[model samples]
Target: MKPTRFIDSVNCAIEGILHATRTQKHMRYHFLAALAVLFTTLLLRVSSMEFMLLALAVSFVLFAELMNTAVEIVVDMISPGYHPLAKLAKDVAAGAVLVAAFGTAIMGYLVLARYVLPWQKAGLEMIGTESETGMVVSVVLVLIVVVIMKARGGTGTPLEGGGVSGHSAVGFCIATSVALHTQDPLIAVFCFILAAMVSHSRLLLRIHRPREVVAGGLVGVAITVAVHLLFRAFG
Candidate 1:
């Protein structure tokens, strides 16, 4: 393509992004979240590999949200009325955004949790950690339960829901498990603080309601605690 044509295409893409940012509240939230993620990455001084992963996750979420907006706009233009197919199309597009958002949240937690909860390494050493199998299993269980709840509620997709904050659930599960295994008061406090921040982020982003956040945290705490108890009893 000619330089002028390429420039026009770039301008059109920029205009679309600006239009979506202006019109879509969720898009604004995603932009803010991306900014916060970038700021946190800078503060943590993550390695180049970690930085690349974080950047890619952030970009994926924004791209998904933009595509979702475009899809909705196109569906509205074409259908222009309450049609089942149009609704399905919009929901599928929104689901894509939800998937991206959920993936980003998990990635952010994995990348940032260590930096924010610096005591975790010490705790792990103190516990003489055998394996992360228990924690991993607990996380998987929480996710399954959250997905089931969301499906039953029919309010949102499995990845994004008003039922429970999957991000908080997984984050706190790991945090609480680490705290319990370490049996350190300071570690426990810091872990809870980190978990609280995760919960607060969901509320701050308006992705989940206050009840949902609390429920998720409670679910995480309960599952982790139970798993630890069982391990102690058996082993």
Candidate 2:
């Protein structure tokens, strides 16, 4: 049977996906591992909004991968004889995917830290305990990014996970940390509200997408949970 143009396009896309899986098997494995960690440590414990954010980020990565595959195929077709420009184009496409994957992983880590290990470390009665240290770390990290962005005189890079905007990572961490420690429903509500506000601020300030903000939030909460589990196992 002859395939229609639409059918052919669909087949090409499916082939692209399969080719991506076959050629980038290690990359796919890494993504799947991250997803596993994300689901177990972050998604399970967060609010519905957090889960939505995770879904958005994951979708972004998948889209990036598809685009990357298309770019590679087009480049190969156009310059089958091998040209420097073709190599550059393909490299750039692959690089973009790497950046996206790296950003998502970082966001996942931040969320896990917050939800999994919100409290201070064991045997700490000092003024600057582990929890205090974590807060300080957060403050410093945020300020550093803000300062760097200011120094750059621009956003630096507006990729899906570039620039100093740690919307998904930091927001998730802070929100999850607050949610885990406080017993009151009001507290959870307030914490998430604050997180959402911060996320909105990122978009308003033109630093991130709604997706990025949500990713940060999920990563933060997930990280908290992961850390808690780790501590329990080792301690």
Candidate 3:
């Protein structure tokens, strides 16, 4: 019996993912970072929205890295020797990952700052307190997660192709955080509008597909909400 088209397609995708993961050291770093983020999110009891944003950011970086890898692979296969166009293609692909990484870093800072800034304002005693301690710890852990995730997901890495949009994720995360922190509805609304603009820019640039942008936004909102709820429940 022969496999159906769907089955074949699924198998091929799985094979590609496996091959990329196995051969790419960068992919392993990303995987570890993802795990760290997930673990810290749970540990800190971050709001659902916060967790979602983190997850989306992670996914986006990995996706970009994977796509970068794919592009490099294709370029190498087509032009095994040095070629200007091939170099350009690889550079462009790597540039995409770099852009995503920069966005992810910004998102990480926004998310972590939510905790660190408040704690700092309260002084040393606040840092010593259990709640503040937990928040600080969470921030540190989240940073670790971002660092690991961003370490390598770019062209030339083994596992690279199709990632979530870090720009979208960061924009949404910032919007959600602003909304949650500010009780003023008008302010929240304004922040959201700004975030939407940021997300729209990604689409306008043709750097990300609609679904990828939407997914990134959803993840940011979900994670933020989750983190808030969890902290409320446990704290």
Candidate 4:
């Protein structure tokens, strides 16, 4: 489809991503790995320069993979028959992805090595965490996303599994909010433990599967962490 409007162009780009993610397991893996790495940067409080370098490396790998996927699709479409040239094209594209991935891995290791804490690190103690405004925004945003997820799934009510857990989501959201606001590792640990119990009850009662409860908890925690990170990153 030809994109005539700005929104259409954006939609087309997102569609490409969706198609790639659905069809390519490697793309999905890279996305999950990138998410984990980005979250680690947040937790480690890496310098902005280091974060930018890591982000660039991630982008380079993703870009190479996307191009490789595009090349493979085009090659398959054009050469439905078995041909050495087609195989070579695919192999070369795959090779590009491998090289890009390897380089990015090295870059990530170098950037993160110094930031990683030693094995004998001191006890966990976080101080002067995010502001009140960030905490409030995070909780509100988590609630909004939870509702959206529940509505989109439409399989079960908020409290039930099959859908986002109204109880577990809010429980985790509040727990995350309090944890960030308190700036105490022990407090954060305790709050998250409580949140886990709330989700566990859902599992024991059979109102939702373990997957559903875990999904809800992840949603809440992810949203809260993202909001706090945004606040800390910009303000």
What's each prediction's TM-score? 0.54, 0.43, 0.48, 0.51
Give the best candidate by lDDT. Answer: 1
Answer with 1 or 2, whichever has the higher lDDT: 1
Q: On residues 49-162, what C-alpha lDDT tens digit does candidate 4 reach at each position?
A: 999999999998889889989999999999999999999999999999899898988887788766653321222223236678987787788778877887888787754555
Model 3 Cα lDDT, one tens digit per residue, 67-98: 98899899999999999999999999889988
lDDT against the true structure, per candidate, is 0.83, 0.62, 0.67, 0.81
Tens digits of lDDT, candidate 2, 85-203:
99899889888878877777666645554564434322112112124445545545554554454356453454333444466566656665555445444465567778778778878
Q: Lowest lDDT 10-mer window, candidate 2?
A: 121-130
**Runs off by more than 4 Å, candidate 4:** 120-235
Which model is ahead, 1 or 3, in terms of lDDT? 1
**Clashing pairs counted in every model:** 0, 25, 34, 1
The Cα error of candidate 1 at residue 65, in Å, is 0.4
- Predict model 1's lDDT versus the native: 0.83
Best of the candidates, TM-score: 1
Residue-level error in angstroms, candidate 3, position 132: 28
- Model 3 per-residue lDDT at 220: 63
The per-residue C-alpha lDDT of model 3 at residue 25 equals 81
Please write out the lDDT profile of model 1 over residues 108-161, one tens digit for every residue: 878888786656566545554423677777788888888887777778677776
In model 1, where do residues sit more than 4 Å from their true spots? 1-4, 119-235
What TM-score does prediction 1 earn?
A: 0.54
- For model 2 the TM-score comes to 0.43
Give residue 124's error in model 1 in angstroms.
14
